[model samples]
Target: RATKSLSLTATSPINIALVKYWGKVHEQLIIPANSSLSITIDQADLCSKTKVELIPTAEGAEPQLRLVLNGKEDKITSRIRSIIELMRERTQGVRAHDDQGHTLTLDASELRTHSLIITSENNFATASGLASSSSGLSCLAFVLSQLYGVSESFPDEYTKFARLGSGSACRSLYGGFVQWHRGFQAIQELTEDSAKVSDQSLARAVELSQESMEWWYNNLSILICVVNPGDAQTYQKDVPSTDGMKITLETSELMKLRLEADLAQKHIDQLTGYLEERDFPKFAELTMKESNQLHAVCLDTYPPIFYMNETSRQIIKTATKLNGQGNIVAYSIDAGFHVFLFTLKENQVKVHEAMSVLPGIDQIIITRIGREGVKLI
Candidate 1:
């Protein structure tokens, strides 16, 4: 008998980049111009949970794709459609056990006749510069993979699908210190084909020594301070990230320097060393510098995009002040106004106290770094 339907649930943790991914080499393929490193935030504080149901359609009938987020129907974006189509094409005669332990064979032709219903929800605000898309898209990709019986044909194969949905989503597929490589040293080094380049542009977890992992788990504390709460609509960006990156790549002179110097790779290497040595001071310094440079590059753009507000500046000042006495905290901001303060567990209380007094702060969440990525539920 033909399988009636397949369903799976997945949860993914968001990641905050220390070595940020600011630009793209291939926009359609979502390949980055530079490598990035990030720590996966624990799901206890922030995450996206997604469930996918694939119901087979009648012969010759076009399958429908639907997405519901936070209990509201969301338009399935072109980026998302691309992921679904690609996954369907890639699904050959794959076999896997469903959630009920029933053996299922997923064929490409058979998958093409299935309609997908995806329902996702985030514990935190979406599009609020909190990496909600990363967790959301990654969770979707993971659940789809299970339903389609898609296995990793190559290293980080599943991440490739997630990357198509959102550039940062690739990094969210792994836990701990994850690095998303830019794929090639130079675009000229490879053929003009984007397909081959995308295969190389994937994310992997940076292997840390057991001792270092233990230290990180024991001491590291991530404090997320949401500047704007309530509705996600209020926090939408003036310029979408894709458009902002295009402007920076075209007009920002500093972008040329950033690419030529390969600053992202350098920061990744330095940060990795600092993490291994458990050098909090060097780690904090590098983290803050990278964050500053990212925003500076944005300012250098033609239209000059400003993601940080007065409240954001106040948080930076507080982190700096606290660091002056001792390197107790390092703050990193994405293309949004909220601040992620990285500090030791011993100083977490101090950092929280300082952040609480800051005006415009909505709420504070205290969580540790996560050691796992996307998981089936």
Candidate 2:
């Protein structure tokens, strides 16, 4: 049966992982090898705005998906197709009822047949090795969920559903300080009398950030230096992260040692504590160290992957100088050459001074963390 037309709009902010998610346990499911934490930057700075509509199609009409990113037609269609199919499968067993308990559709088959029109635009450059995919997919998932009334029926499926589009996209769905907890860690701590809940069925409050200290996240400033400024459309890694991880897991003995030491767990513990206590020194130290080790793991890969260049190393040096001058800035470089400098609001002047004088920096973007999460517009 044909359905009435419906549309929804949404915006989701980009997130930068502090404890990076470098490997995957299940690529199909997008399950990470370790839990990762991130800060939701200001929505006004970098975000993706999306509009999803469900229009009644002709009896034999096929689903139509139109994607325009940053005002240009791109090739992200296949990813969106996978997401829709996955969501449809999840909705298979679901039965939607009206106010009077009347079934809305004949069955799941009828619902899956419904077509959707998706239009998305990003505030920043997409496919440029930036976090555009994370934000765009997040916004898409949120809008799609609303169109399907998934938000009202099954609240827990939102992030998990968004994850199908992109792994880091799940973290973008939440605001403030968010962590995609690796479910396996739950096994080490639960009591005997506790329910037989797997990592997926754990119990915890949704908002991990404490309200009394929400202001802490708001005041933190992040300065992004796009050293590589690669095209997001083809913003691929010099060494594909997935391929690099496979080689690292199989060949790098350091990775095995790090796993044995529970390196990510240790980093998370210290970083979380430093964040809570507002210890800039400890926070900065661990951030830099983890960033270094992450790259070291990449280098440890069989072929020795390299994402950063000469200018990236220079940026790190400049950040250290800022720290020495009492500015207290911490820098983290991801798989790309982009550098994320974390500092407090008070040290923004020093940050400006240091970044402005630095040569070869294409752009220095100043923004904050712990911003409001995704929402309908």
Candidate 3:
């Protein structure tokens, strides 16, 4: 008998959602309430690197599985465990895309019979909002699937398993402009039983080819200013983001008008056109309007959670002043204190310089929208 070991590693980049994913539809399945659009950031700036290994285990001994994050061993979350189990069951070869579909046979594959070890690490700084988690899980799924040859066999299921860990994680599986379709019922129709799943879903993802990568990569820039360089876990607030969204969904009048798939599609249509034509003014307009709309929804929340602080407000005012003078610079803030300045590459220098001196801004992170996604190594 011969001892055997197999190993592989992969890296994936973080992303910023232009069209935000706010609420949840199926909490148990991690489905989003609405569709979302995003672009990945450069892996060099921020990413998650994961390595998975399978080694022959002693006969009759129970196989072991372990995961390490940032060099520290930690217990695996149930979501990740679900992904592992799904991968194990897939060894018998895939059937149709139906969730109720079954494997052909219960074959003890190489992966199932061996002890496994998975290690992942994020390249982040103090100002990081821990945005790398999505990329981390995405990288883990990518590498393991690559080893199992899932990208060619069952690409949709590969992405679907990533979403099991985090809703946004599915989007990081692709590059360029990406969309995550909402609702599970609608998603089933998007995939063909025997064909490739080209479109995206809450359980899967699709990457859209906007302008060529070269065009956007050279023309667009995002200047991220960390107004509050604090860990999201350590930061305290009146209402947690998830709780705040739930309150808004139930009580806010604005939520009644805005939380619909039709609205998302309308915005997606116009934004997609603007992106292809490089219409900075229209692009900036949508960016600013959608951002403010999100904040308005926050304000309309029952208890009114304030993710944007005084400094955040000041940056908005400053950007308004710049845009007043015929500049296309726009800003967006997530449910956090950091502000993102979206501007043309030509004006990036001026936009970055003007925002750097704002009071309470601790650090400036210069980054362009990345043109690629996860890669197996």
Candidate 4:
């Protein structure tokens, strides 16, 4: 059979989780203890573009998967090679036909024969403590899955692939209000069995994140405050979010106490209740508390990685103060200290004008909830 060509592409946005994925129960699989929620931003000039292509091979040569990164030929290391191996393992018996009558069998060894090209570019900037890595990696993984014929039912497989590349990539699989269900790898293991259950809870949970009916869609806007992009020389430094979680497990006695007393759930529910009431003060309080908890765990680490600096703190304080009274404005910080300020559309110009004057601030990009994830042309 003659081998044929194939290509796929996906553009993914950087998402900020409301109920964040702080710790993981299963590090290897990237499972989280609690669920997380996020909104996909459309503008503010941040995104990742990924393209995947397949080519036919000759009869005798060893299969090769060439990875060209940023227009340069790159070697596949052990870490990335694992994903190809897993893809081969999962798609062993499955057969895919190209435009020509050729059948492609995914063999671990033969992956090298065809070139798997990946090129990603961030719209605004890279390593400025922005979530570009997450969006880029997630977009690559998503594009590859589509090219390789993987289904969403195999989220663990795809998300695990993404997680190996970037910690937050897994959550990008869904759009609105996603949750990783931390430390729970069995969600994928039992998916086949659970699919038979009558309640269909998994379907419902997936629905919740993918739904477009969330309250903040039209009303909420986010302002991005950029700093020096955080030590550009330290680009793509591996933080290992799971490792951070392990450190939290050992040092954050509060985390253990919350787990034992089920306080995290109670606290999360309280925040949700407040959101239901449209109470900005309470929501802001919970968001600030959660950010503090996340950073506290970061501090609990041996070397103590500090994600939030003086500039980060100033933005937080100013944004919180500006959204005063019964107003519906809020601020939430992610793994990086970048502040994602949620406010009304009417407040956009004023917030931008105000942030422009702040010291150590670079630029502000305004964005709102993006439409559901889609394929690129």
Candidate 5:
């Protein structure tokens, strides 16, 4: 038999959620408690590049899988294993033409006869709450789909696969403005089938008018402020997001209000309108408010998850002070110390300067909003 080896590479940009996804309704399916919205960062500035290869294994040998992240050998987490198993199940009998124009067919049985190797690297910090998993897992899903010739059975089908690896990862599968729908209510009211629920939990790009797109590209800029340039792994949260969410749901009264109000969906709707109208002040206000609410919910959680440090608080104060004079800047922080500031290109320098002078800020990266999502190199 001819040596059948296949490989593919893909890159995905990090997506910073404006309307955050803090909790989960379904853990195994990675369903969110609330819908979320985000802007994809440009891949050139921050992204994860993932490459996968399948090589035939000896007839009597059990196929093995290996993963290397950022030049370090890493154990295949259960989440990643689930994504691979899903890809294998979905890609059975799928066929496509490779880059060399050779027709390739994927066989479920034969897939088990091959060893898989995945190498992924991120240009930015990981585990420090910069949404590195968003780019990392999305890139993994994209490369796997491309390699196996997996076709989307529904709209954003691949996004469902990405969501299996990380909830926010689904948003990274698209570019420009994207939204991850919270299908928990729909799933509960409908059916309990896992596959159906996964299908309903989807992320899709928000349609922006050509003018809005142009304005966003031309006028908007993001400043990523790194609070500490130390090893990102050291900055990993004491409380994992999943655990934090579970505690919040059980203990935080504010969390109850947040869910009852459907705050995330509301913010997404309002932000979408503000973006369309090119109303920076309204957009900025909503963005900052949502960020505050997310942290507040964290504080309300029993044992209170504290993802922000004093330096993180200082950045928020500085941004707020600057915004008092003019709403030229808005700050959003995820479950990490890094602060993402959104401002117009005209005020980029001013915003960067203010952030740079703040103590404990080690680095500030300037990049524009990304217009594309995961793509083959």
Candidate 6:
């Protein structure tokens, strides 16, 4: 008998959503109310490097997985193991080989020991509140999927699975203003017979075509106000982000307004049209207002959750007031404290210079439209 191993490496960027994905409807599935948009960043300087190996081992042993942060051997939990187990089930008969070049079977239950070494590093310092966890989790799920032999043919499902680990992660799966469509729950309200018929019709009517959706290509820049810089920490101390959102949905009336905002619909339509027309000033105006509206709801939360600070607020004001010419720049933030400044490449240097003078801030991380969600190495 021989042993074989598969080593795969992938990198993903931390994204800042223009329209935030703060709340969730389904905790386990991580379904959001509305579609959120984002642009991926460069992976060279900041990313997660993961290596998954499968080995044939003796019986009656506890299956193991390991995570290494920097050079230290950190611990792994059952939740992490469950993620691998789920992948194993979905990828049965998919095998890796050891350095000896012999095939090694990957059975989650049969394995007594395993090594899933994950090493993540960031260009900026840790605790900066830059949504780095979103990128890291997305990359982790992505690399594991490849090493475990899950087919890449279904990009949507693959992205949805990645979202289970981090909501913003689904956006990281696509490049250049990717939208996560949280389709209306009209299906949930259907009668059983009607639901079956509707499902069948949807399956048939879904056309896989690209000709109609190709107008979105253009040059857009996603600039990060990278504050505080070390590695991003997992939100394990609080309720799972998904569960926190569920609790919010139940108690927060603002969440209700967010779900049913008529003006918001109008704003989205007008902004989308403005985007298409390249109306820089109007687009930037709408983007700033919409982001403030989203944050208002966060303020309405009981006990309140503040995702911004004096510096973030001042940056918004400075950018809005200082616009004297060309392409207008827009700003948006997510659950974390960092700001995502968007503009055309021509206006980037100006925006960069303007933001450089703001107080209590660090450097600006510049990223353009990314290539794709996950790439294999």
TM-score head-to-head 3 vs 4, winner: 3
User: Order of candidates by lDDT, top first?
Assistant: 1, 5, 2, 3, 4, 6
| TM-score of candidate 3 relative to the true fold | 0.82
Please count the clashing residue pairs in each candidate, in the order shown.
0, 5, 0, 16, 0, 15
User: Which digits, one per residue and each the tens of the lDDT, describe model 2 over residues 226-302?
Assistant: 76543432446677666777678778877877766778878888787877776777888898888888889888878
Residue 68 lDDT, candidate 2, scale 0-100: 66
Looking at model 5, the pairs that clash are none
RMSD of each: 2.3, 4.9, 6.5, 5.1, 2.3, 5.2
Question: Which whole-number lDDT from 0 to 100 does residue 125 have in model 1?
Answer: 71
Q: Write the per-residue lDDT of candidate 6 for residues 56-89, one digit (tens) a residue.
A: 4335554346676555676664435556666777
RMSD of 1: 2.3
Which candidate ranks first by lDDT, i.e. highest?
Answer: 1
Of 1 and 6, the candidate ranking higher by TM-score: 1
Q: Cα lDDT of all candidates, in order?
A: 0.86, 0.72, 0.70, 0.61, 0.84, 0.60
What ranges in model 6 sit over 4 Å off?
A: 56-62, 75-79, 96-115, 122-126, 186-218, 228-244, 262-272, 324-327
Candidate number with the higher lDDT (2 or 5)? 5
Residue pairs in collision within model 1: none
Weakest lDDT window of 10 consecutive positions for candidate 5: 186-195
Score candidate 6 by lDDT. Answer: 0.60
RMSD of 2: 4.9
lDDT of 5 at 113: 78
- For model 5, residues 172-223, the per-residue Cα lDDT tens digits are 8777899998876632343334556666778989888999978998999999
Residue 18 displacement in candidate 1 (angstroms): 0.2
Off by over 4 Å in 2: 1-3, 76-78, 92-113, 152-155, 186-212, 228-235, 325-327
Off by over 4 Å in 5: 94-106, 127-129, 184-196, 229-233
